[model samples]
Target: MRIQVFAILKDFFKKEFELNAKLYTIADLRTHLSLLNPNATPVLNRCRFAVQDEFVTDEYTLTGNEHIVIIPPSSGG
Candidate 1:
């Protein structure tokens, strides 16, 4: 499975890198992310989670074929 990093998430991640992983749920993915950066948790919790562009909840299960993208809410003029 692969997940995309967007907006400020890219900064926290240090890059817009693809995670080549095998996580089954959004919560499962969170655990992996927490290991990488403690700063990621609050953002991860508030962000919109999508699989192949459609929004999904944290309980949503992942399929190997989908592309997951995490995007935090943006505020600007």
Candidate 2:
């Protein structure tokens, strides 16, 4: 699956990357990513995931062909 990351996540992973593992759900992907980069776990826990422009829950299923986006929290004043 192709993943696009934003904010602090982009610092750990690049703006875009690909994962060919068999990830069944958003939750699975989250775990896998955390395992890949333990330092990103805290941020990943708070990140929101989206597919096809719509926010998805951790239970959301993955077909392995969709382009996923990982958006981290942002704050501005």
Candidate 3:
């Protein structure tokens, strides 16, 4: 699956990237990501995920090859 990251996450993750794993849910994706990018785990936890252009909970299951949008909370002055 491809996780499209934006905002600060894009910078952390070096823009968009592909993930290949046996992940079954958003929670699993996050866990897998943490293991792959431990340095960004703190910020990763603050991110929200969306599938099929709609916001979804972490428990949402991924059947495979779903392109997920990773949107992190934006900061402002």
Candidate 4:
């Protein structure tokens, strides 16, 4: 699956990357990513995932070919 990360996540993953694992749900992908980079777990937990420009829940299923975006909380003045 292809993943695009933003904000602080981009610091860890550098914008985009691909994972070659069998992930069934958004929850699964979250766990897998945490395992890949434990340091990013806290941030990952707070992130909202999006597919096809729509936000998805943890129970959202994945077909393994979707382009996923991981968006973290943002604050501005």
Each prediction's TM-score against the native?
0.78, 0.95, 0.88, 0.94
Instruction: Sort by TM-score, best first.
Output: 2, 4, 3, 1
* Model 4 spans with C-alpha error above 4 angstroms: none
- The lDDT values for all models are 0.78, 0.94, 0.86, 0.93
Candidate 3, 17: how far from true, in Å? 1.7
lDDT of 2 by residue, 22-63 (tens): 999999999999999999999999999999999999999999
**Predicted model with the maximum lDDT:** 2
Model 1 vs. true fold: TM:
0.78
Model 4 over residues 1-77: C-alpha lDDT tens digits?
89999879977786888888999999999999999899999999999999999999999999999999998997767
Span of ten consecutive residues with least summed lDDT in model 4: 10-19
Candidate 4 or 3, higher TM-score = 4
For model 3, residues 1-77, the per-residue Cα lDDT tens digits are 88888887765686777878999999999888889888879888998999989998999989888989987876868
Q: RMSD to native for every prediction?
A: 1.9, 0.9, 1.5, 1.0
**Count of steric clashes across candidates, in order:** 0, 0, 0, 0
- The better-scoring model by lDDT among 1 and 2 is 2
lDDT per residue (tens digit) for residues 26-52 in model 1 = 888878897788888888778877877
Clashes of 3: 0
